[model samples]
Target: MPTTASMTRRLAIALTSVVAIFWFVALGLGVYVMQDEFTEIFDSGVQETAERLLIIVANNEARDASGRPVEAAVLAPALNSQYLTYQVRDSNGMVLYADGAQEPFAVPLSAGFSQTATHRIYTAATTDGTLFVQVADALDHRSEALMEGGTALLLPLLLLIPGSIAAIIFVVRGTLSPVAQLRDEIHTKDGGNLAPIDESALPKELRAIARSVNSLLARLKSALEAEREFTSNSAHELRTPIAGALAQTQRLLSEVPPAFHQRTAQIERALLHLGRLAEKLLQMSRAEAGIGISDERADLLPVLMVVVQDLERSPLGASRLNVKVEDGTALERSVRADAFAIVLRNLIENALIHSPPQSPVDVHIDINGIRVTNDSALIEPDVLVNLTKRFTRGPTEASGSGLGLAIVKRLVEQMHGQLLIASPARGMTQGFEVEIRL
Candidate 1:
C-alpha cells in the first residue's frame, strides 16, 4: 500500500507537471500570435522606405537633360540591424539610381507590392515612365530578434519549479503527522485497555474521527462490564445450592445400603459436575475482564505442582500422572501464573477423568511450550475439531461438565497465547494431546 507522504508527493508533482505544461502551451501560443504581427510591421517598414526613395527618383526636378534621372548613392548604416538595401529602375528596365550592388529581382515585376525571392518591390508611375523601388530585409535578422524575445519570457520559471515542489512536500508532511500519531495510539489498545483517544490537540478533521473511536470504546467497556457482573453473580448464586446438594449426597452415602450406594455415588458425581461448571463460568468472566492480562510473569513449576495436587484429591486420582521437564528449561522461564494455573488444572483434570485407572497421563514442559498427552483418550477425528468449543466433552463414559477446555481456551487467548488440541497427538502412535504455547 502507498503511504501518506509518498501519495502526497506524487500528487504534488503531477499537479506541477500539469501547470508547467499549461504555461509552456500558453507561451507557445503567445509566440505564434506575435509571429504574424512581427511580419506585418517589418514589411510595412520596408514598403515605407521603398516609397520614399521611389518618390525622390521619380520627381521631375530630379530628371536630367535626356529625361533620365542622375544616379544617387545611399550608404549602409553602421548598426546593420535589419539592414535595408534598395534599387530604382526606369520604364525600359534600365537602372536609374541604386544603393548597394545587388539587384532584388532579375525580371521587372508588376506594380503595387510585388514579392520576389528576397525583396518586397513597389512599382509606381509618377508623370513619366515606370519606377521600381525594391527593398530587401535579411530573413535571419527577424529570426534572431524573435528568439531573444522568447528566451527572456521563459527563463525565470526554471528556478521556481523545484522550489514550489519542495514547499508542497513540506506542507503535506506537516499536515498528515497528526493522523499518523492517532493511528499509532489506537493500534496499541487491546481488550485490556479501552481508554478514550486524546482529541484536544487534533486537527478539526481528525477530531471527529477520534470522537467516534472514543464512543465505540465506551460501548465496548459497558458490554464487557455487564457480562463480567452477570457471570460473577450467577457463579456465586449457583455455588450455594450445588454445594448443599453435594453435602447431602455425601451424608446420605454413609446411611445407604449396598444397592443404594451406586445410585448415591452417581448423584454425588452430578453435583460435582454442576459445581465445576459454575466455577468455569466465573473463570470466563475473569478472562473477559482482562484479569489474566498482567505483565508480571512467574515460573511454571509451582503452578504445575498445584494443579497436579488438585487432581490428586479428585475421584480420578486412581490414575498416575507423569511430568517431565527438560533440564535447565521450563524451570526458570516466566509464565502467566494465575491464568496458566487454571489452564493446567482444566487440562490435567480432563485427562484424569477420561483415562483408565492405573494408566498414566504424561505432561512434559519444553522450552517453547507445554504438552499434555493421554493414551486412554480415543476420540473420532470429526469430534476433535470442535473439542475447544464451549460445552464440549470427551466420548468417555465418565461424567463431565464440558466447560474445562472451553475456559482454558478463553483464558489462553486473554493472555495472548495459543491452545491446540489433537486426537492421535503429534509424535505419538495413538493418544490425545493439548499443546499450550505462551
Candidate 2:
C-alpha cells in the first residue's frame, strides 16, 4: 500500500501532468494555425503575381509560335519578389517564356487563365489566340516561411515545457513541506509521545490528511504505552508469587518435619498473589477497552459514608482510620457518576492500602468531590505522576499490587470525574489526596 505522503505526491504529479498535456496540445494547435496563415499569405501573393503577369502579357505586341502576339518582360522589379516566380507557357505544357531564372521551372497545364501548379498559374489567350501563362513558386515560399516561423514558435515551447515542469516540482515540494515535517516528527516519535501535530495554516487539501496521520500516531503511541505497562506490571506482580513458589519447593525438599504444613501455607500465599494479579489484569483490560460506565445521579455524602463504613469493617477498620466527610455550600448535592458502590469501593480500598499502619487514613468527602488523604510520605514526584498509570504502585512502605490507585483513577474518569493527588513536606504530614468530582 502506498503511504499517505507518497500517494499525495503522486496525485500532485498527475495533476501537473494533465495540465502539461493540455498545454502541449494547445501549442501544437497554435503551430497548425500559424501554418495555415502562412499558406494563405503564400496563395494570395501567388494569385496577385499571376494576375499582374497576365496584364503584362496581354499588353505586349510580340508574336509567338504561329504569328500570334505574346507579351514578355525581363522580370520587372515589382514582379521580382522572388516568391512570385513566373513563366509563360504555350497551350502545351511548354515553358516558352520565363523570368527570374535562367532555366524553366515546372510548366504544368494552365487552361483558360486558371491556376494549375502548386504555385498559382494564370493562363490567357493573346490577340492572335496564342496561349500564355504566369506562375509563381508559392509552395516553396510557404514551406520556407513556415519553417522559419516555427523556429520562433517551437523553440520557445521547447524551453517552456522543461521550465514548467521545474516550476511544478518546486511548488509541489513547497506546498507539502508541512507534511514532510509531520513525517519526520512521526519517525522520531518515542513510545510515550502522543501529542497532536500542529497543522495550522496548511492548505485545505492537506489539512484533512495531516489530521488523520496525527490521529493514527496518537493511537499507536497509546497502544505502545499500554503494552509496556502491561508487561511491566505482569513481571512486577508475579515476582512475589514466583519467589514464594520457589521457596516452598526448597523447604519441602530440605525440611523433614512439618514440611507439608509450611509448604501449604507458602503455596496458598502464592495463589493469593496470583489471584490479585488476575484481578488487576482484568481491571486494566476494562480500562483500556474504554467500556462506558452507566451514569446516575449520585449523592456524594451518603455514598462516601457507606464506602468508609465498609472499609471500617475491613482489617484497616480495626486500626481505627479516621474517615471524614466535608460538604460544599452548593444547592445541588447530586452529580452524574458511575455506580456509586464501585467508585467508593475502589477509593476506600486504595486508601486503606496506601495509608501507613496505625496511621489514620482521612477519607474526606464533600458534595463537589471527595479527598482521600492518608498519613504517609509521598512517593517520588515521577512516581506520583505515574500513579494513575496501570501497574504503578505507591511507595515501597505499602504492600500493594500498584493497580489500586490506577483503578480508582480509571473509574473516576469513567464517571466524568477527575482524580488528583498531592503530598506536601515530602509525604511527611499532609499525605496524598485523591479529589473526585461529585
Candidate 3:
C-alpha cells in the first residue's frame, strides 16, 4: 500500500530546510565580507610599515669608518610571534635590509601594493627614488584568520540546526493538532454515530469546516431517522392485517371443497411469505436505528441458547442442528439482548434454510467469536461476496427473504463487530460459513 504523507511532517521539513538554507547563505556572505575587510586592514598595515621603513632607512643609514653610506638593517624582536615579515629593497630590486624575512621578496621594486603567490607586498620609495622599502605579509596568515572567523560563525549553526528542527516540528505538530482532532471526529461518524463535531476548540481556519460537517451530519441523521420510522411504521401496520388474512385463508382452505383447496392454500402460503417479509423489514429497520450498541453488559450465552431452542421447535430444525460452546467461555458483551437475538436468528435460519436436506447445521462459540456453518456445495466467490446484500441470495431454490444476512451484517457493524462470509467452510471441502468477531 502506498503511504500517505503527513501535513505536519511536510510543513516541518519545508520550514526547516528553508531556515537552514538561509542561514548557510547568510553565513557565506558574512564570511566573504569579513575576508574582504581583513584583507584591507592587513594591506594598510603593510603599506604603513613600508612607508615608515623608507623614512627611517634614509635618515639612519649605517656609515662605514670613512663616513660613506653602507647597508642598513632594522630588526625588532618580540616575546610573542610576529604576523608580518618584511624586507627592504633598493630601486634595482636589490635587498638592502631584512627583518623576519628569510629571503628577498619575489617582486620588482615599485611603489604602491602588489601580491605574489606567498605574500602581500607594499613597496614605498624615497623622494630621490634611490631606494625602496618593500614590506611583506604572509598569505597563510590572512587565510588562518579567515578560517578562525568562519569557524566561530559555523559552530553556533551546528547547534542551532538541530534545535531549530526540533522547534519547527514541535510548533507544526501543535498547530495541526486541531486538524487531527477534527479528523478523528469525522472518522467516528457512521450509521451508529452521527453526532455533530465540536467546533469550540477549533481554530478560526477550521471552524467553517467543522460547521459544514456538522450540517451534513445533521441532515444524514434526520434522513436515516425518517427512513427507519417509515419502515417500522409500515411493518407494524401490515403485521395485523397480514396475520388476519393468513388466518382467514387457512379457515377458507378447511371450509372450501377439495377442488378449491389448492387455490386457498396458495393464498395462505402467499400471506405467510408476505408476513415473513414484513417481519424482516421490521428487523432491518431496528438494525438501522442503531439498536445493537448498549452501555450495559450482559451474558449473551443464554440469549443464544434461547434462539437456538426456538428454532429447534420447528420440524425442519429438529435433530438437524448442532451447537458447541467452548469450555470456560463466556458470551458477555455490550450488545443488547434483542439485537443479539435477531442476529443469531437470522444467521441460524439462513444456515438451516439454505443447506441441503438432512445436512447438519453447526454453531460453534469460542472465546474469539461465533461461527455458523452449514453443509452445502461451494458457493461461487462472486455470489458469496454479495450474499449479504438485501434481496441477494446464493444459487439455491430455498425460499428466503434475502434480508437475513443483510440484517446480521448491519447489526454486527453497529456493534463494532466483523462479519466474514466464506464458501467451502473452514476445514470442510464443501460448505458455507459465517463468522462474527466482536
Candidate 4:
C-alpha cells in the first residue's frame, strides 16, 4: 500500500495543474483585452494630435513676411519626430507644408483615417479643395506595446506558481494528519490490546472510521475470550479421562500375556497421542488469549538448552540433541518466553520423531533467533506447503497427532515473530530445519 503522502501528492499536482491552466487562460484573455484597449488609445492619441495640428494650421493662416498666405514650416515639436509626423498637400497635388519624418507619404488627396502596409495614417480635409493633413504612426510600435503589456500581465502568475505549489504541499499534509494518526493507532494494536478508540478529538470524516475500528476490536476481544474458555475447559475434561484410560491400559497390559503386548502397545500409543493433542490445544488457546504478551523477556539460548535437556528425558523425544550457541549470555535479553517455549517444544518434538535412528538433532541459537536441524529424508514441495495445516502428518514410521507445527505457527504469530520451515537445512539436501525469529 502506498503512503498517504504519495496518494495526496498526485491530487495536489492535479489541483495545481488546474489552477495553472486557469491562470494561463485568464492571462491570455486579459492580455487580449488590454491590447485591444491600448490600440484604441494609441489610435485616439494619433487622431487628437492630427486634429491639434489642423487647428494650428487653420488659426495661424500661413504667411511669409507680408499679409499674404504662403507655404511655411510648422511648429518646433511637429517636424520629423517619432511621435507625431504630418504632411499637408494642396488641391493641385503640390506639397504646401510638410513637417514630419524625412520620408514622404503617398497621398491621393483623400480624407479621414486610412491604413497603409507599415503605418496607421489619418488624413483630414480643410474648408478648401480636397487639401489633406496626413498623420502616420508605424505598426511595429503598436506590436511592441502589445508585447510589453502581455509580458507584464503574465509575469505575476509565472512567479506565483512556485509559491502555489508550496502552499498545496503544506495544505495536503495538514489535511491528512488525522489519517496518519489513525494509522499509527491501528498499527500498534494487537490481540492483547482491544481497547476502543477515542473519536471525540478526531475530525468528522475520521470519527466514523475510529468507531468502526472500536466495534471490530470489541468483537475480537469477545471472540478471543470465548475461544479460550472453550479450549481450556475441553482440554481439562479430556485430559482427565485420557490419563485414566492410559493408566487402565497399562494395568491391562501387565495382566495380559506377552502375546497381547503388541495390541496393548498400540492402544497405549493412541492414548498418548490423544493426550499430546489435548495439551497442544490448551497451548493454542493460551496463545490466542495473548496470556503472556508482556515485557518479560527470555534469553532464547538458555531456553533452547533447557528444551534439549527435557527432550532427552522424554520417551517420544530424540535420544540426544546437540546444542550450540554463538554467544551464551549475549542472548539473555529477549521477550515472549511463553511463545518461544511453545514453538521450540513443538519444533524439537517434531524433529525428534522424524530424525533417523540414533542421529543427534542439532539446535543452534544466536543473538537473533534459533534454528533446529534434524537429519531426515526430504519432503515434497507440494506436501510441505500443507505441513503447517491442522491435522497434517508427515509420512514417517514414528508418527504424530499433526497439530505440532500448526500450534507453533499460531503461537509465533501471537509473539510477533516468524516461523520458517525449510527442507534440507541450508547447505545439505537430506535434512529438515525449523527456524524461529523473535
The TM-score of predicted model 3 comes to: 0.77
Candidates in descending TM-score order: 3, 4, 1, 2
- Candidate 4 lDDT trough over 10 residues, lowest sum: 327-336
Candidate 3 lDDT by residue in tens digits, 222-268: 98778778876887789989989998999899999999988888899
Task: Give Cα-based local distance difference scores for all models.
Answer: 0.73, 0.62, 0.85, 0.77
Model 1 CA lDDT for position 78: 18
Using Cα atoms with residue i matched to residue i, what is each candidate's TM-score against the true structure?
0.63, 0.47, 0.77, 0.76
State which candidate has the highest lDDT: 3
Off by over 4 Å in 4: 1-7, 55-61, 64-86, 91-119, 127-130, 192-212, 256-264, 277-309, 324-336, 377-395, 413-416, 420-430
- Each prediction's total of clashing residue pairs, residues at least 3 apart in sequence or on different chains, is 0, 3, 0, 3
Tens-digit lDDT track of model 4 for 1-438:
975648568867888899889988988998889878987897887777777777666655644435876444445465436655777666676665676554557645576677778888887677775456778888888888888988887888877787778888899889988888898888866765566787987899999999999999899889877876887788789899999999999999999999999999999999998798779878866776775354445556666667778888887564578877775435543346555677788898888878877778888887667888988889877877889898897767876777889888887776677888888688887788888876
lDDT of 4: 0.77
State in Å the error of residue 1, model 1: 15
Clashing pairs in 1: none
CA RMSD (A), model 1: 7.0
On a 0 to 1 TM-score scale, where does candidate 2 land against the true structure?
Answer: 0.47
User: Could you say which candidate leads in TM-score?
Assistant: 3
Comparing 2 with 3 on TM-score, the higher-scoring candidate is: 3
Among all windows of 10 consecutive residues in model 1, the one with the lowest summed lDDT is: 73-82
lDDT (10s digit) by residue, model 2, range 248-348: 66666456467466766666566666766666665556554443243224345555566667677777665566765554533133232223455566666
Candidate 1, position 374, lDDT: 84
The CA lDDT at 438 in model 1 is 76
